[model samples]
Target chain A: MATASKAAADSRANLPFVYRQYSAEQLREVLHKMYLIRRFEEGAEESYMRGLIHGTMHLSIGQEASAMGICMPLAEDDQITSTHRGHGHCIAKGAEVKRMFAEFFGKTTGYCKGRGGSMHIADVAKGNLGANGIVGGGIPIAVGAALSSKMMKTGKVVVSFFGDGANNEGAFHEALNMAAVWKLPVIFVCENNGYGMSTSTARSTAVKNIADRAAAYSMPGVIVNGNIFSEVAEASHKAVERARNGEGPTLIESKTYRHRGHSKSDRNRYRTKEEIEDWMSNRDPITLFESELREFGFIDDRGIEAIREAVAKEIADGIEFAKASPSPDVSETGNYVYTEQA
Target chain B: MDAMVRELSYAQAIQEAMAIAMDMDERVFLMGEDIGVYGGAFQVTGDLVDRYGADRVLDTPISELGGAGVAVGAAVTGMRPIFEFQFSDFATLAMEQIVNQAAKMRFMLGGEVSVPVVMRFPAGSGTGAAAQHSQSLEAWLGHVPGLKVIQPATPYDAKGMLLAAVADPDPVMIFEHKLLYKAKGPVPEGYYTVPIGKADIRREGRDLTIVATSIMVQKALDAAATLEAEGIDVEVVDLRTIRPMDKQTVIDSVKKTSRLMCVYEAVKTLGIGAEVSAMIAESEAFDYLDAPIVRLGGAETPIPYNPELEKATVPQVPDIIAAARDLVKGVR
Candidate 1:
């Protein structure tokens, strides 16, 4: 009996942080969310190719694990500010895919009522303050939200997600410094995908790692393998705890890669095709997370297939919902410019 | 707006309004550089830190862009933040957050959010601060649709309009002239609000309409008094709000007087005067013009460091009087 108890303790210690903490059902949901983010981007790309959606979209096809992991430790009321490449963030923050697709379709039934397209998608009810189009624009805004949380005694934490390129922006430094000085409950997550548009981090960034800059603000700089869901989730858990305990902000650098170009207009000239193929084949986040789930016995082949089938159905339904939604009237273009006076 | 009134400087009235706003709502707070123990660059927020403490009256680092963006973020997330730019010209540094984020947030979010933030600017040239420190850039922000820009000419309007801005559901920008901070006028005590988007007729006449904004209003009033002696009968209209301007008041005054003269402190070309001139020309008041419209505005040059040069750069009482005399006498 003593040996069996010791063996159980060893097994629990060997499991990933989330696997040890969460139930099997909860772990399966995490896998489901990861798959949902992947298929959602795939569906969006297909729709974009079919001429169903106008304007451009920043797809996060290869960065699903980063979004899911960082958001795993957050409560429903915890707030987050996203970036232009923010579809995964929006989904992870609990935005309905139907509304997201409808927004891309510019329908009145969309999340922003068709006013904001891909870049500005938001679900404020879920505490996802809209994704900003400007690089590093959401950094200070997240600090402000954290300031509100601190001042109002709301006990809520805020996360600011930006690219590695944003580390060079003045807003990032100013915001991080202020957050540290005020001891505000906020987390700064830099999803360093190695490039900002066509410029690589080595070409644009000054530091070896984006996390290294957090030392300037006197906050803990954490780096994690963003493709590995367990590793990213573990780092996010510690950061979230630090924020909630009134210890001030933490900076987490999730080193991930994006399969697609920066936008629809990227010509694929800057990086080699072989490098993209390597990340796609060896480090795909959804594939890694699924294997982990299967290894832990949290999900079987049937369960994985079932999750994929469900996600496919949801994506198809979301597209149908967006296609059927009505466009806003052109005459009402002036609406929402100001709060309509009573 | 109340029976009990006392004389207060424009700066003091603004301070009292901020205190009253803080007292009324716990969510209201002030943010700026040196607004705390240092009492601000112009002493406009003097000694409030002693009363409300540092948290409520935050003294941010000299980070205009980041500070403004934080205020926008705080405002959107259910806090009423009143941000003060030490100098109006510094707004150039923070225009991205002001114009892109604060002004466009509500519209871009499909009316899901309202940024109830207030920004104060100490504007205009005088006191020999040179070109960088002294500039009337209200027109730059006034050009945005989602922003409400106001230039209160008196202590009463300064206090009342600030309270109104705090209570407003949208972002409101207040441009206070540094020279006007020491200027005193009657101010009522307690809670009161001067309605925004309305013009005040400072003086009435029948010969010509002198439409003015900010410190230019007082200059126009002084000029009107001088023109009265010369049988000009000049009417002075204080254009309190720049964006969503009170066009009907200016139009009626021009139609009644049959002549128009615009006076402003910004550069003469493409300033408030141009907008007022174009507005009248496009309105029913166009046919009422007995003479060519005149714009008494700043000279087409940067505000220089020399006292005399600074005096010449912006419109003065003498300049307004001369412009009004020409317009009333039908001399282009």
Candidate 2:
């Protein structure tokens, strides 16, 4: 018993978070994608403030590392179901900035033709099952996708992304349990962003980490620092590999903080500005990865500036393109009610 | 071309439809609790596991929410998943997936994709499974816009409609009454499809029109038989698909008969009958009506365990006869 326990502890202590060195171009592309999501969300907030974009927006400003890292290893056919704060997931999964901005701007050019706005944006053609409005709503749907993969022998994997608040939903438990039972190829990525709108994980979640609950479903559960791209990448790569190998699902608790409030309407009364500042100044994923790449001799200070300039121009251009896009005709309102009624 | 015809029960017919569909399409699979070895809670999926193996005929965990969620997930990923709810009453556990996810995914996603999922619910009150196990929730499912809600009244429809639902691109909810499963009818041997949203004239007459669904159709047919002896002709239109409503058939029948009666096993208030009533009331049939539209549905109460009380809630043959007499006699 002592030897067995010691082996488990040693393996747990030696988690493989070593950064996989990539080409200068590959690193630049990844950093560039992260920059795109950050600026796109900031633009959405700016548009909301200016009364150009209506309805609510859930920003994934601080959680970009987890999104890019987790989706990096996924195939184009691999599926993902993200939460309300799913702009990062959608962008990381390769959604165009123009279409995303167009969605926020309520244009027909948007992924959902201005009907879904931000919370419901999706690109099913790109294998993004959707961004759900309801918390934990996508878990079961992702599980269903995984079930299809297993039944059809499609050799595809599904990643179900939800917040810490969503971890408390019955869907989370039900989906996880079934996925485990059937050995469905699913990776449940819990973005533990501390707060579910206003309620803190400490106030609501019973476990120390969301991954601890995975044991109930008889699957491997691991915690990774979501702020560090390497950790998320390594953890997700292993999980995704497990899924592809037909070993079944894994529960990954990506412990990260949302740099912005839960949604656009929050006033920051839930926590101190000091806590938010601590995360931003100390653990911002974009800056941390930039510094890491610099240390690795991947790029210099000049390269960083060029990347930033490129992304800023892309964001401005995308926003302008979205502004030029038209709203859907009222005639299209009733077309999708059913699939042509058979 | 003459096809082989065999008299099969509703359960056998449904099983045959799934078997033929699975054979024709490798993408089709069945998922539900106890459907594999146990053959399903109501034995509607008997011996399918033996023929299709455990992979195609899956026995899910006893979590309806989880089972339904996985089925929804599978359906969207290019598989024709026929998910069975043990009873219509237990569908409350799967409302999130059925209503929010399945019915709204295509519309919410701007029609980029469609969920070709088929969910079968053994519904209506006849078995002493009481309130939790016997409820006609088709009206509830029919209210959702992006769903094709079907109620196969006869063995012929039970077979044909199930095949058609598998072919539909949108989510289709098939409500099979527990009592209808054992009722036998002539089903064709090979693959065929009954057109969805099209009503079938079970028995045609001229004096009055009876629009009935599921188990209520049989009762209405018996009532039409009794009304024949009373010197009043009746037209029986079996509404196999409820969501599409077959409004044109009912309207045309009412126009011909000049009287309308809508019957279902759900609660009388805001039921499918109400929709049938309003359809005629708002259409050209309204001008041809000799009397007000009569809707005979179950009483607005939970189905009791006692066999007599259970039978009392919904319209029996005698109750249908009495209601038909009142409507034809011009009694308000």
Candidate 3:
């Protein structure tokens, strides 16, 4: 009877999820990053509306927490593969925002010299593989990166970010199965922002939750509050640690909502205005983080105002840099087609 | 002053060149489905795994897409990987990796990366491999902007072209005819790199210029020999590389001969012959031509498994001889 009671007590003790405490400095840094991403995207939207941007852009307006939280645990050597909505991921992963802005502006000073435009910005130095336009394209690529890490014994992990809609892709299943069989050090993070384009998750996927799909691959699957930066950060930390320790890949479902339409061209007819207003007002990640930080005595009204002003200035500087950069030389069209031997 | 020339088959020459390259460079590795232990489906890479060991001579699963992706990734990351497709027909499975990623990566990335990868395919009909494994699809790859396409006809060109392909910085696709591997010619020993995008005059004559690729080169040479007996001396030009095609050499040969006949094993519709014919017609060589350019190619149809049917699907030696004879005679 005494042993049974002791076991029951231990089970109860492990029931509540333990969260990692953040200091004032850490909280401020997270807020600053979120504000920067928000401002950058907002500026991009204005530019697009003004006919400055040419190509299709999928902005990560409301999914700031997932990018910042996941990237917070990654080192400079760790790699990540992103989806089309990759501006936030790139920013959080420490890419120069000015270069990213220049990329969107189609300037030679952009990350890819304007060749990649909005969909394919990659910075190898920052360990960002690149953003992919093809659905589920980056899953297997991340697996390859993780395999390279294992083979080279670099102890580096790769994180692959995809949308909820990508779960239906054959590559998703194949990549996850391969990663599982080989115990690849990768993290499969699904940003389930309710819809994959105009198609809702309920209509496309049979399973209620994307996390449940992990059982097929026999890996650890967890659902987290994506709008809450602390929750996302803590969950990502555990997953990254597990992968680094050779425990194989993990599937994380970040249940969140995108405040904007899927892309710049979306009419928002699939969902109601009421749904958008509710998510924006009640489930806003930035607002939630601000309230939490204020409660923890980490920030006040003046600090928030200063952060907003600084972000505004950063956006303005990025635009100026992009406008001043030169276009790529047309004569060098055949350059770099192949690597020349020295 | 010339040494005695010996005859060799295309397969033997490719095998010899691969063996030599492996001996010369430690970084060069070959991988394909059943290429290692099976010696390749057509035996082009005979006993390579045993000689170079498994790490360098890898046998992969039958996943062309996955295998090509790995090769491209490895090539970009500092390893020189040579991939073999058991048959050229299977390349469709890897078009995404080849066309989209390998061909566009360096350009899209601002020239920061290089795909120094070589893919070899046993192309054309002759084998009773049916429609699934006996088509010549080099024209499809040549149409892409960044890829280098090479089709070597003679054993000597095979050896030299492969060496050049290994040395080149870009991704090169070498389409080897299944029937030509057993054909023979004299091959030099040791490290020799033939310049890519250069045409070679196999037979120098004045009556007409017969441009050919892969197996058609032998046929063109045979036709040239036959035409000489008929008092019509014909020049045969072997276009080793199709993409960065040797337009100058081809035009020079046409200007000298005044008549042109482009031949290939691929379908006549938009084949390498079409590109060569168009180039000749557009160049200064057009004014010197005594006869209109003629292109002889495979009929547009699936290569049937029946031996006779398969042989009929592609351009044969007799077909080239007849075509060259007609061109020399100014026949429509």
DockQ of each candidate relative to the true complex: 0.82, 0.74, 0.37
TM-score of chain B of 1: 0.99
DockQ of 1: 0.82
Poorest 10 consecutive residues of model 1 chain B by lDDT? B322-331
Q: Using DockQ as the measure, which candidate wins?
A: 1
Query: When superposed on Cα atoms, how far off is each prediction in RMSD?
Result: 2.6, 4.6, 5.5
> DockQ order of candidates, best first?
1, 2, 3
lDDT of 3 by residue, A258-281 (tens): 899888789999999999999899
Off by over 4 Å in 3: A1-27, A177-183, A206-223, A242-248, A296-302, A329-342, B1-28, B45-47, B50-59, B183-191
Worst 10 residues of 1 chain A by lDDT: A1-10
lDDT of each: 0.91, 0.89, 0.83
lDDT of 3 at B8: 62
Which stretch of 10 consecutive residues in model 3 chain B shows the poorest summed lDDT?
Answer: B1-10
Better of 1 and 3 by TM-score: 1
lDDT by residue (tens digit), candidate 3, B65-99: 65676577556555677889988988998787788
What digit string (tens of lDDT, one per residue) describes model 2 on residues B1-332? 97799999999999999999999999999998899989988788899999999999988877777778787778888889999998888899889888888999888888877899999999988889898888999989999999999999999999999999999998999999999999999999999899889999999999999999999888888889989999989999998888887888888999999989888899999998899888888999899999988889999899999999999998889888988899888777
